[model samples]
Target: MRVIIVGAGEVGRSIASNLEQSHDVVVIDRNPDVVEGLTYSLDVLALQGDGTELGTLRAADVAEASLVIACTDSDESNVVVCGAVKTVSDAFTIARVRRRTLLETWEGSQGAFGVDFMVCMDLLTAQAIFRISGLPATQDVDTFVGGLVRMAEFEIGPDSPVVDTTVQEADRYDSLTFAGVFRGEEMIVATGDTLLKAGDRVVVIGSPGSVTDFADDIVTPSAEETDEIVIVGASEIGFQAAREFEEHGYRPRLIEQDHDRAREVAEALPNTLVMESDATDTEFLAREHVDEADVVIAALDGDEKNLLVSLLAHRLGVDRTIAVIENLEYTELFETVGVDVAINPREETAEEIVRFTRAEQTEKVAMLEHDRAEVIEFEVGPDSVLAGEPIAAAATDLPDDVVIGAISRSGDLMTPRGETVIEPGDHVVVFVDAAVLEDVLEAI
Candidate 1:
């Protein structure tokens, strides 16, 4: 497959990175520096030019590509690039568009504009945070559904009280099942006598509320004093998020683009300072004393704008810097760019859709590296060879790079060692890298 990516920045680079692994990839950017650096470092073809120009699209050979992605910082540029690509070829086009105003206007006209999919990073990231925060006890929550079910991770801190207890005993505390534990460099499936030591990372799946309560118990056995958090952005979604932060006792300082809008938002939200200034202005951020804040949440409506503000916060050395990204395509770039957290609402929403679509075929599914790698969950059927076999026995049949995470039979969860038996009707979770997903599925 051939893929053409526009915008060599974080989101563009991320899309290129994923597609390049399995396809013929080419990237075009107006900035020569970004093109040279990313292309050389990533070993993908980079062309220097404007994506919206037909000549540039032809130079990149977009006509032969199966997929074309417009990831430029400017929504207008992305739309124009997609329009030009579609005019030249019948390939699928995905555009990164971050403005709510555009969404309200475009409503259902994106197809007419030649865009197959539109990514809104701010709304997506905010939705991700909101979905995770719904399970407040869980340190990190990755939901396969919008909210129907969740996979939550919890850190066993020093004061977790159950730190030294066995997995079985710990399971009795809350009704949540102990799926797996990450200890140091090893992954262990939970067992009756498996000891839960401090610093052990536990994975669990359950309803959102129950998961949050369970996480709260594991992370902070005792009540924790809420810390202050500063959120920058006064957009509608930003205002909604400010309410959530304030409700948690966070000292929130919201900055808007205009004075009148700021005053109006301030009138609606008490105990929150709503001032007027662009988040990209470092002087305004520092003058507002955002540098001293415990955590800075950048909920700007634009991906590039949020990125710039996030970098500023990082440069200023904030304890935490979280940016709202709607584009699921750029998720990996967050890690590569050293951004603490990249939240994508569309990615989260799309995940929910994909999970719903594949719920019956697999026990569970997790999209890794921006949906490039698919983690599948399966239950051993009554007649499958996996039934009644030990983990070691299954290991011999399974190919390399496949890890059997956990087993649950008759509501009892067990960490499978090499000797552990997989009885019929057992539910199991497996981590399958993208390269071997098909073989892994066939083996299970």
Candidate 2:
């Protein structure tokens, strides 16, 4: 399949990189430098031109493309690019926008602007914040198979009870499958003998209840109940996050430095307490008793400001500090410097758009640890290698890094084991190394 992607920003670049090995990928960018860089770095065709122009679409051979993704920085540009693609090609089109209003409008209009699908970056980031904040030690969270299965990345704290235990010993939960572990720069596929060390980010896939149980167990067993939730910033993401918390029965406090923005958010979210004050102000934070808040989220506009707010909240005795970062490079840096979680909107948008491109047979996908590995869900077709075969036999054909995480049959979650026979139509979730993702997707 030929996939044409517009905009050479992080989201577009990420999608191109993930699909280049499996599909014929074309990337269009206005920046000549980015085009030249992608030409040499990736195995995809890179063109220097505006994506919304007819001449550029002709040059990209859009008619032959199977999918076209518009991910430019400007929402208008992305929508226009998708609209332009529809004029020339029958390809599936995806547009990445940052505004919730646009997403709602697109949804209400039944795929308006000729966009086959749309991804809202701010809304996805806000939802990601809510998911990560719900679990105690989670750095990332994604649900698959209609929420029947959950994949979570949790940082094993230094004082956690499961620290220093092997995968065999730590496999105490029912219906949970240890998928992979990220220790420093190494991505270790889970095995019975693999040791669980403190600070290691472990990825697990299983039923939602089991994942939640594992989450609570990995923490040091907190006795203190969460009383207050504070979100710092009235940025698009911050406002959406406050609203998400409110919808889920939490009356969160939102702090915005701008008076007008605070008043608007207060009016919009009646259940939320919107305050106008500088979150970084020590006196203001102290006066408002921000130190007592169990969770503090820094959703400021700038990366520097978010970092400052998260650090300040940490200093003020906040148990968890989540920050929204625009630069993907700052995720590790921010987390290393004491931030609990760094939510990158571009990364989340890229993951969502990339997942849409794999609907041929794959049902869903969750990218892990910056695409070092992936957890994919797909139905076992009649011709699939896993169909009518035990997992132990199927494992021989799969890559060594692959793990049969979990399988669901007839709406029932089935934990994959060596002796378990996978049948046709069974929705199986598998963990695969990114290096062998193309091969796994082809076989499964």
Candidate 3:
């Protein structure tokens, strides 16, 4: 597929990097330096021009493109680019916008801006954080198969019950499968004999309940109750997080520095406590007993402020800290500085958009091991290579780095064994190393 990406920002670059491996990708940016950098770093075509301009789109050959994604920082620019692409091409258009109001308008008008799909970064980031909060000790969480299956990453601590056990010994959950283990920099395709260590980051795929149970058993248990969620900043991200938590029976306290914004959010969310105060103020945090909160989410607008709030919360003895970082480059830095989890809105939005560009057989895709591996959910078609064959027979043809995590048939989720038969219409979850993604796709 030929894909044209507008704006060479973090999200645009990420989308291009992910797509260029399997599709033709062209990236456009107004700045020459960004275009030069992209050309030097990524395997995609980089063009220097304004995406909203007609001449630029024509020069980029939008008419023959299969997909066009507009991800400029300005919502208006992105919408205009998508609309312009639609005027010239029959390609599917995806617009990345930060404002929920714009998304709602487009949805209500049935893609008025010519956007076939829209990604709201703030909402996606908030949803990710909410999911992580619900699952104990999970760094990331993604759902697939209509929410019937889940993929989660958990970091094992020294005190974890499953730290010293082999993968087979720790396979106590009936509906869960140990997908892979990331030990420092190496990703190991987990087998029955794979030894789980204290610092290994393990990825698992299974039903939601089973994954949660496995995570709780493999990671050090937190005494923090699920209901005690504290959100710093009544910004859009914070408000969305509060709304999601409230829907899940959690009464979260939202703190905003602005008095009027706090009042507005309070009115909109009756279940949340809207407090008007500076979260960076130590006295205010102490008075409110923020340390007692189960989770402290730094959803402030600025990355620096969010980092500061996360550090403060951690210093105050908060068990977990989740920071909303706009800059994707700072995700690892935030984690290194003691934040339990760093949510990059741009990265999350890019991943969500890339899922739509995947092969038709792939139901969902989740990035793991810093994009070095992927957990992909695929449905077995009648003509698929694995259909009507036992997993053992197919395992010989599969790549060594790819492991079948779970198989769901007739609403039953199973941790597949070598003798398990893969039939048509079965939902199979596979963990694949990035190096063998294409081979796995071809085999399945």
Highest lDDT model number: 2
What ranges in model 2 sit over 4 Å off?
223-227
The lDDT values for all models are: 0.67, 0.92, 0.88
Task: Residues 68-120, candidate 2: write the lDDT tens digits.
Answer: 99999999999999999889999999999999999999999986999999999
Candidate 3 residue 271 Cα shift, in angstroms, is 0.8
After superposing candidate 3 on the true structure, give the runs of residues whose Cα lies further than 4 Å from its correct spot.
Answer: 221-225
lDDT of 1 at 136: 30
Q: Backbone clash tally for model 1? A: 15
CA shift of 94, model 1, Å:
0.8
Q: Summarize candidate 1's per-residue lDDT along 300-398 as a digit string, tens digits.
A: 778777777777887887745667775656655753475556766545544443443344557567654344445456678766657778888877887
lDDT (Cα, tens digit) per residue for candidate 3, span 72-166: 99999999999998888999999999999998898899869899999998888889889999876788888887888899999887798997899
- Angstrom error of the Cα, residue 230, model 2: value is 1.0
lDDT for model 1: 0.67
* Comparing 1 and 2 on lDDT, the stronger one: 2
Query: lDDT, candidate 1, residue 441?
Result: 64
